[model samples]
Target: MAEERLIIPKKISNRFLMMIGLGLVLLVAGIVLMMIAGPAHHDAHGAAAATGHHATTWYERFLANLWLNNVYFTGIAIVGVFFTAVQYVAYAGWSVLIKRVLEGLGYYLPVGGVIMLLVFLLPIIFTGHNPLFHWTDHSLYEIDGPNYDPIIAGKSGFLNIPFYTIRLVLYFASWIFFAWWLRKQSVAEDLNGGLTFYDKSIRISAMFLVVFGVTSSLSAWDWVLSIDTHWFSTMFGWYVFASWFITGLAATTLTVIILKQNGYLKMVNANHLHDLGKFTFAFSIFWTYIWFSQFMLIWYANMPEEVTYFRERMGGYEDHYTWILFTNLFVNFVFPFLVLMTRDAKRQMIMLKLVCVVVLFGHWLDFYLMIMPGTLRGDSGFGLIELGTALTFLGIFLNRFTKGLTEASLVPVNHPFLEESIHHHV
Candidate 1:
């Protein structure tokens, strides 16, 4: 008998590469458009210097804002891919069936790194002050500066540009290194078919999880929470974690179902779907709990600083703020809670996939709500730029993820828990 060959399918890689190239092109084009539009200050002050309908440049500002928001949202999805990989490594589950799907997703980490680097460097590169991060205002640290915010000044040490850039580099480096190592080990198992590969993964995973937790928390603080420099929450780290965790699981479930439907991973049956659905269901509730806890605590305390966050969201943008709260609660909590609570729904591919899609979009909106209100401010209507950017990233992600699935054997035949995973129920 001849040994089986383990070659990755070429078509999948080609398709993925093409989509990735398209996404990069769009991302770069969007950035250029934003740069051309210049800062909001120029538009406001130079209105008299323009002509005709282009005089106000309202359309240009709108496009710039939309593209910028899309950039941030797509960046979140990129983070989602990274988060999924971390969880897989941490659990060391027999997710061999979809491990390549995750590895494919991992490819986006470097892309995400580029996006993040662009965002972080944009202020300096373009000489445009970052509205999202007040600490970036170097003049504020100067002795005679008049535009300095006291709060930002107080935190200058931790939030300085150099420190911020260093932390971000470290975070991206750690994630990329760990993701690459784990993928290498998993693929090596296919060639070696020995317990040594599994042992290596186990040790690395244990160490990686500890590092992952710390870095993830800091990254969330640096990336998201710091947007509102005045507001601080001890639970903010866990709050962001819960959102990403649920989103990552939802994405993973969606990928699995899509592959299974296409006849790629036949070994993953309803039982596997059921297990994935359960995680989606449980995490929905958990996310709601953290959300409410954060909201309720702030509401009850009613401190000026704390309540200001919600007040800006709920009072200033009442319609969107209300809609976001309702949609997040319903799609992430209510719908999934009702649908996935049942044994039949969990086993039903259609229903499970439906729930997964809802959860994924819900969390995307959740991040949107968290970000846009603070960043885009008054002109935050969802439009073509947002949708286009999302489609661009989704197309790229799916292309990469599917190719990864076809790269390796759908099932890890040598995995110790491969049979257990196939038999997973409830």
Candidate 2:
């Protein structure tokens, strides 16, 4: 069968415009809501008496939102390339029909990477008042100073600005290189018509997997785990990856559904949808397993340091994160598990779409829980700031994503397994 190239309709274009416009309005409003309280935080004594104690500044809260969001969306973008690379390495045939969609999701990587670097820098540049990462302060390492922290001093060799900056650059550099290289090979294969590009992609993908094995984990450690400064987890790397991977799977599935509904991706069928649903279903369970293992181990160990992490999240004087922590498990695990359990449900696009949307928001909340608790002690970070910021990010991501789809056929026509994908069945 001949592949159909995407010619984005006027309505879809208009829809994205409206989405972007609405996002911008909300983003402006969220920015005001977040920053409106900025002036009150500055005081000679350095404590806001109004909130009594532990009253974090609005900039701190804003930076927290920015940091978590940068990490969250960066994971989403990298996992796109990661998913495609995995498909290639496994010699997977059933996913060929949806491969371009994955590629489009991935093309958002360079943008996300730049945004991450900028967000990381913003905390340091803003009068050296880093609410998102308290460890970044140089005073904490001064042994003679009143602000001295033995723990932070000990970890300073790794957590220092120069080393952390290098890793940030390298992670994005490597990830971007792989994303670009594979995309180039894919386009070459489409033009030249051979297995040469395909085999080359496998080799490159294998190398990428090895690189990712190290970087993804370390990046997670740097970006999210280090926020708490004192807590550590063996399960954190995979835990973050699971949320990212499954969220990418759901987003990819959702994009395919939208394209099909708009009268594109002609070779894709219900069987393809079912396969996508199955991947989403399986990964939701996988994510749950990782989450539960991490939680249960920490709960059982009862170690002061280990338990402190969950203690803050599970209970506080404010009890801020307790509900959202449980809600994260339910949304990411239970909802998908129960909804996508049956064969019929997997085959149904409506069910798949529903699961995908919820899973996306669920993982957003998951990241919110991870980062917000560390930055702001008394309040839940589940309001306009998060929602508007995410929508703004979505609009930017969609613009890049749609542009990528228009650059190539929605179906990769020259793929060796294109026929297998067209006829894919459960």
In terms of lDDT, the best-performing candidate is 2
Taking the tens digit of each residue's C-alpha lDDT, what string does model 1 give over 74-184? Answer: 344444445445545566454545555556666666666766776667756576456556567677777667876777788988998889889988877887787778778
TM-score of 2: 0.94
Error of 1 at 325 (Å): 2.4
Q: Tens digit of lDDT per residue, candidate 2, span 5-64? A: 888788877787777688668756766764675544432212232334466655566667
Alpha-carbon RMSD of each model: 5.6, 3.4
TM-scores for every predicted model: 0.83, 0.94
Which candidate's TM-score is highest?
Answer: 2
What is the C-alpha local distance difference test score of candidate 2?
0.83
How many residue-pair clashes does candidate 1 contain? Answer: 0
Name the regions of candidate 1 deviating beyond 4 angstroms. Answer: 1-96, 318-320
Model 1: lowest-lDDT 10 consecutive positions:
44-53
lDDT of 1 at 322: 60
